[model samples]
Target: MSGPAIEVDDLHKRYGDLQAVAGVSFTVERGEFFGILGPNGAGKTTTLEMVEGLREPDSGSVRLLGESPWPRNPRLLPRMGVQLQASAFFEKLSAREQLQTFGALYGVPARRVDEMLELVGLSDKASTREDRLSGGQRQRLSIACSLVHDPELVFFDEPTAALDPQARRNLWDVLREVQARGTTVVYTTHYLDEAEILCDRVAIMDAGTVLALDTPAALVRGLQADTRVALPAGLLSASDARALPGVGRVQDGDGELVMSTQEPARLVQALAERDRLDGVSVRTATLEDVFLHLTGREYRA
Candidate 1:
């Protein structure tokens, strides 16, 4: 395979005595939609800022498309697009005017502004002042401004935060369209399901440390041995269920029993032989389960 589009080696950052990012390292391949997932204050934003050349790391290094991120290289700036967690704009500027200003900075043609507005579903709002737009509409405009330069790579930080479900879905579709065009994306969000659906691979981070890195399917498979199988009532007690073939653990709850095992198929067949199984349901491991198993806590907490 070709070298990574983005690479970091033992990346570290500090805020006074606090070590915000501690030796985190990962690589994002070209055209890959990579996600960085973590709870609040997990150093996710700090890490991304360092990668985007907005902040200097206290130690370690970052390489963006084989070039150093520091010193804010002018040539590299136009090739990258960034949408911060919190964005600001001239409140008096209309959407079209704002896009025009940024377009001039990148030396892009004025026509590109209208194209991006349409791409992000903000064309109708082009004449609206930034302050008059709703939060979701402003976010869409921010995304549109980021793409006015037609960058090859984009960094989206919590792009769906604070939006209603419908608006969030709209943004998700827009992002899908961006990816379909072969532009690489590095996304950071608290939404695990979004990451699962949109990202080709992800790196789970906490307290500046990388807990896991892999495709969502591969990460979930690592917990396959802890798979759960739920069986219906009057079937088996906890102890008897544990004694069943391939059953590693079993817990009875009223009319239902949840059995955890490395070999669910064997347990199912064994239970079937005794006529003790009814309405059985097997749940394969999921990304959320892997996050909880590895971190011993909920993701949003």
Candidate 2:
């Protein structure tokens, strides 16, 4: 409460000969929205589990809410909530009943059940059975279950892993509202763009190690990447775009001529002066660029 909400130092975990998490360290400030990003098998979930006290680490230490999380500390359980990647529930239980069941575990007040339903946008589907809910709706229910007892710190493991685009965006609003209410949110996700917009700071991990850790803006800025200027394909050929001022690299993109430049404003000014501004679009470096830069574009398991 007085210091950081969560602090991890040199965390390590191994199964057989494979190292799942190697030397991971980071801190989550009170009321901060933190993100852990990595490819599949990058140990994001394992690191989160160790921090949540659900799994024992092979080395290093974790201080969660000013107390050790190992050995399954019961005192900390009530203050923190964890949503696993695979949500679990009774198929026949309605959304309301599912939440009530979780609230019962913490001896929460009866009114809290309705509060969670509304909080996760499940009030209309309160009577819908768990099996009947859509993938996004069920994911929302899992989140509501995690927060039924009013946890101060919540951990989400890829809450929007497989949902449709619109649903993923909708869940982002709910996550933002949770942090707005002063709850510290620490979650792992493969969605780089989502983390770029939602997280206060992020840790990009690969091969069980943290490659970069910083705010989304900071990470992108540090990349020192180029800005992309695009124009209608027929407006200019790749050779002509290459000759334009401030153009460093030019390639023919799908239906457009893409030109990369460090001086975007200068390039735009040049284009404007040339009366070639039609259908012009500018693309700046993004967190996805930083992520792909850190973890190469190669396929990952």
Candidate 3:
């Protein structure tokens, strides 16, 4: 019903001899879960900073909520929430106190502070000092601080970077709840699976430019990769698998027999005919495949 919440057009930035961000452009619709995925030094953070008005772009334009983000626009500040990679909390402040201080800046009421603590699962750690909290709890506190003002658009830079798997999943639930409340979420992550599960659409960046931009499923579909079907070891020999109607490549994986084929249906039917469907597992084209196809396997600086 309204224009896009964010519109970035041909954004460019450079540092000394390095072109940090070059001609990156994309749009984020209101209430959309948009993810910027890339490896280290892919200019994801630089592009995000330019969009958040923290850095000046050498060229191009960014319209956030229909307003320019550059020059540290005061009018847009209250409407945006930014959670940087490094969390900063007031010295000696407890979790609740940290949120209280942030809420005070936005004139938010006390009840909202309680709600934020509960929302981020920080209610129990409300009295814990920032320095005394665990890495996960501190990360949650940083998120609570950014969201205490109830901004419409939230930006998170690798929010789950160093957390354990369990904590990362817990934060995923919290993020889902945030999006459920109609907040536009724009985040950057190195985890391809996480992006596929969380984002409605994603932009994959490399060498300071967008290499692929689309829904995870759409991008994977475009790759046209052969499906991989894995069967239990000792179920069939390699020669038999290779002789199947649609099987292309057969390989022996750890305790499993993996086969690749374009016509998975025909192969599966052939396996079924032989009564070898006991431990069959199928993996179709995935976001990881699409990411690698675009960004390649080279290490980034």
lDDT, residue 112, candidate 3: 96
User: How far in Å is the alpha carbon of 164 misplaced in model 1?
Assistant: 2.7
lDDT of 2: 0.92
lDDT, residue 160, model 3: 92
- Clashing residue pairs found in predicted model 2: none
Tell me how far the alpha carbon of residue 52 in candidate 1 is from the true structure, in angstroms, after superposition: 1.1
**Model 3 segments beyond 4 Å from truth?**
none
**Best candidate according to lDDT:** 3
In model 2, where do residues sit more than 4 Å from their true spots? 237-240
**Per-prediction count of colliding residue pairs?**
0, 0, 0
User: How well does each candidate superpose onto the true structure, as a TM-score?
Assistant: 0.84, 0.96, 0.97
Question: For candidate 2, lDDT tens digit of each residue in 93-180?
Answer: 9999998889999999989999999989999999999999999999999999999999999999889978999999989999999999
- Better by lDDT, candidate 2 or 1: 2
Q: Which whole-number lDDT from 0 to 100 does residue 4 have in model 2?
A: 97
- Cα lDDT computed for each candidate against the true fold: 0.86, 0.92, 0.93
Instruction: Write out the backbone clash pairs for model 1.
Output: none
Residue 258 lDDT, candidate 2, scale 0-100: 89
